[model samples]
Target: MSETQKLETQISDMRREKNARPFTLAIASGKGGTGKTTLATALAEAAGMGVTLRDCDVEEPNAHLFVQPHWSRHTEQNRPVPRIDAQRCSACGKCAELCQFNAIAVAGGRAMVFAELCHSCQGCRRICPEGAISDENMPMGSLDCGMQLKDPAAPINFISGKLAIGQVMAPPLIRAVKNVGAAEPLNILDCPPGTSCPMITAVRGSDFVILVTEPTPFGLNDLELAVETVRQLGLPFGVIINRADSGDSRVHDYCRTRGINIALEIPWKRSIAEAYSRGDSLCEKGAPAKPALPQLSATWPTTVSVPTAMLMPPICT
Candidate 1:
């Protein structure tokens, strides 16, 4: 087995033998407008057991709209951007050469670093012979966590990573968001759309993934890409066909052919759209989607390979 697969196998063994952490689920979509956030919020509301709904869509987080969490804890997330001291150094171009992101350059007899381009690897600082490079804090985003509902039986903890208005360093901010005290028994990660770095970061440590998609050609096309992404990471995942009736039966056919599980099918309705527009969650008391949530949470995990530690990055500061 490959390294990732071997890690996955060990994780499964640990989960079964050591009873490590509770199951974590990430709701993601191939493309936007696939009802991913909608399902994620509903699942968190209904999963109970003090589940945390982490909105990992740092770039444009909308889970907060549906979660309607009462804010209690908030903190800024920062990344290190280089500060080049021109006075201390000859333009030897060492920092530029060491920067893996090409964020630094020595041009026109001066050294320059692009704040946005820097990955904060600190390699430039480490490699600088003249000690001319230093790190400065750059705000990438913020983290917020609180309760979703007042009821004790199903009180939900909500956490979100909100990226700065124009910043692109979503991965680091996402890493910061994961630093919260997510002691809840269950957690649902509402991942960003697509299979990019941000989305991967959001879903990294999830035990199982719910790939939400519409029933259109566009949805299927992107869903294939997302499937490849998750499979590449050796993550076990299934599909959810949102607006199942809007498009043809291609999605179902595709899943069946691939032996992929279809966990839930949410047919589109005008009322559902209306509730969403009003910032109301699907599993609200009188909402139409309330009755099926428990089943939704229970159905997919029947065939899971447990893990010891989740697919997490290095612990954040």
Candidate 2:
């Protein structure tokens, strides 16, 4: 079989694995406004039963806006922040020296932990020789879980992570969101934009990554960086060009030269853009429905089947 066919077969096998870890697919973009969330929510809605949609864009999660999950459970998420016991500290600056993020600093016999800078790695606690460092859970964010609030019978479990205002740590919260809902057969992670730590954290365990981008120069530029990021992580990925009909073919050229597969292309349409502006999913009835999105589902393993109505035909691809 060709490499593409081989990859599809491998992904199919993963999806069919009984009682194993869920087959994860992360939808990401190199820059904002590339429609990553739109595509993600569409797939999640189309996948129907036995699927979990995780909006891992903790900093500014918007997938919830589209899925409208009626949150049955809300939980506050906290990360460990080092609390130094001054009485036990010798002012030797061990914690400061050991901390890579500069989260801890020692001076004048006082060690202060910068809660926002801490990555919750707990390295300071492990490195403290005098047992001066203790861990305190610092409120970082919140997670909400529920089924489709608008339609309880939609058969989708939605989980979203929202970083508390003024909280700089996002990877921790994203990881927390991912930790839940592993038992589901299929998972769709809507990762944060850009190839940063938060994005990497969300995309880490995904079986496949769908990189969404536009045909514009800005889109092509960031897409290259995103492609590099995913490639370095040694993950299988494909590109989805939004507004495919409007811009030049630089993105296409780049992908062709790199031997990258363009999985699907969503054309630019006034009706589609307007529907998206009103927060409508392409899989929904209100969106400019056309034919079934075979180009996308074709990339899926044969074992996995999305309903024809759910996989609405709105775009050329």
Candidate 3:
């Protein structure tokens, strides 16, 4: 049996053993430098839903810098890549011809497989009449599991997956982190920055999406992009303006014109940054944003209650 088949079988077995009832919420931004992680952690702490934090930003996960976690467990996440058996050698160039990802190349009576380009489709193996193709697992990363120690009085479960350095793909790791949290918990996924594959993987199947943005020109530009991304996904999403008072009013203006709910706003405050630098929980510091943060916890259920079509604007233009 190929490695891909074995891994798929394992995943199926695990799913059968665990019946998961999770409410996945993704925190996203259209660009980097936005406070996606900060808002995700704060909202998780505020919701008090025994939330599991998945730092889907495998490229650079920083949530742990704030929410201290106890009892971390590391587990390997891997993906399948095709392996060619030269000895079984028909070298007819069939595999290379069939591969859509350009993962296989044949030249000079030799076949080379570029594992990174492989999407693990297993088509090459199935099509190989000579049985020269097989699949193998490549280590992607390790997932760290622990509980957030925001309040010694109440702790929340947190899990993050760190992709192996130099790994290009991150969606697999994000999916792995989320799979672990799906067993029986409410989840708040701190998605990676940008509105690309990684962001889509993080937000896909989420109950709600909270897009964090500022009010500057750059912020407005990115917020529009993020909104369009979520809209394209047909997911229910709202806006949260961070550094709300510092920039132009265009963000609020855009939201008002679209009828998008301004879920919460973290004002421009030196203390917020100071507390963050000190690795202090916003709840403990009485951060001016605390009240506003918890207000989201109250608003989320109601937002979910409204029909998605009703919340969306008449025309996305």
Candidate 4:
């Protein structure tokens, strides 16, 4: 059998197995405006109860808008930034020189630090000859927790990361958001768009990934990059084409030729767009995406024996 066919068979087998550990599903995209959030929200709703949805798009997290979860806890996220104490030492420029991010600069017989550019690496603090540099907690963002208000008793635990406006670092906040307790049977992470640091942080430990994309040139171009990223990370993943019928068939052809499984497809629909504008899940009343949610959330093995392991069930034929 072809590689793609074998992978498809394993996916089917995973759905039949009953695994105990909650599966972590990361819904990611290569670029924006691809209806990634819409599908992620709908899948969470379809998975029904016992699900935890973490919005890892700290910069533009909007999953909460659709879910409208009743917030229980809101905590500000902070990270340590190096601070230079003038009274203790000279303007040796050591801190500025060691700051690889150009966050600090010493000139005109003075030293200045740009908090926004700082990565909190603490190299400045350690390299300071006179111990003039110390650490200060800088507010990076906030982490909020709640439950779906619609069904409070069986509400999906909702955790969202919002990076402070103008904040450069999101990985820390993403980590904080994921650190929240998840007792649900399934954890769905709405990953940030693009294959950047934030996206990697969100999908770092996921069991499976759903790559959402359109079928246009832009989508196909970015999808290849995203597919490479997940493959490099050694995570089992599948593709879903949004507005499948609207664009050309390059995406389909690429998937077929490359042996990638097109897990689900959502055709062009005005209602889905309208519903999304209204902050709705677009999963109402026999939606096409509803049927695929079960397979998306199926019990998939978390670990593969090797980095070269292709998509296949270890315990199933």
Estimate TM-scores for all models.
Answer: 0.84, 0.87, 0.82, 0.78
Ranking by lDDT: 2, 1, 4, 3
lDDT of each: 0.79, 0.81, 0.77, 0.78
Better of 1 and 3 by lDDT: 1
Per-residue alpha-carbon lDDT of candidate 1 for residues 6-83, written as tens digits (9 for 90 to 100): 977877676564334656778898889899899988777666565788888888888888877899999888898889
List, residue by residue over 1-317, the lDDT tens digit for candidate 2. 99988867765564455236566788998988899898988887776557789999999999988888778899998899999888999888888998889988887778988888899999989988899888899999999998884444547798999999999899999998998754677788999998989989999967778899999999999999999998899877788899888889999999899877787788888988888888888877857533334567565432122322122222223
Q: State the lDDT of candidate 3 residue by residue for 79-128, as single tens digits.
A: 87888888896789888999988999998897899988876678989988
User: Total clashing residue pairs per candidate?
Assistant: 3, 3, 0, 0
User: Model 4 — TM-score against the truth?
Assistant: 0.78
Q: What TM-score does structure 2 among the candidates reach?
A: 0.87
In the predicted model 1, the residue pairs found to clash are: 11-307, 11-308, 205-311
RMSD of each: 5.6, 5.2, 9.7, 6.1
Residue 183 lDDT (model 2): 62
Q: Model 3, residue 105: displacement in angstroms? A: 2.5
- Worst 10-residue lDDT window for candidate 2 reads 307-316
Q: Which window of ten consecutive residues has the lowest lDDT sum in model 1?
A: 308-317
**Order of all candidates by TM-score, from best down to worst?**
2, 1, 3, 4
Model 4 worst lDDT window (10 residues): 308-317
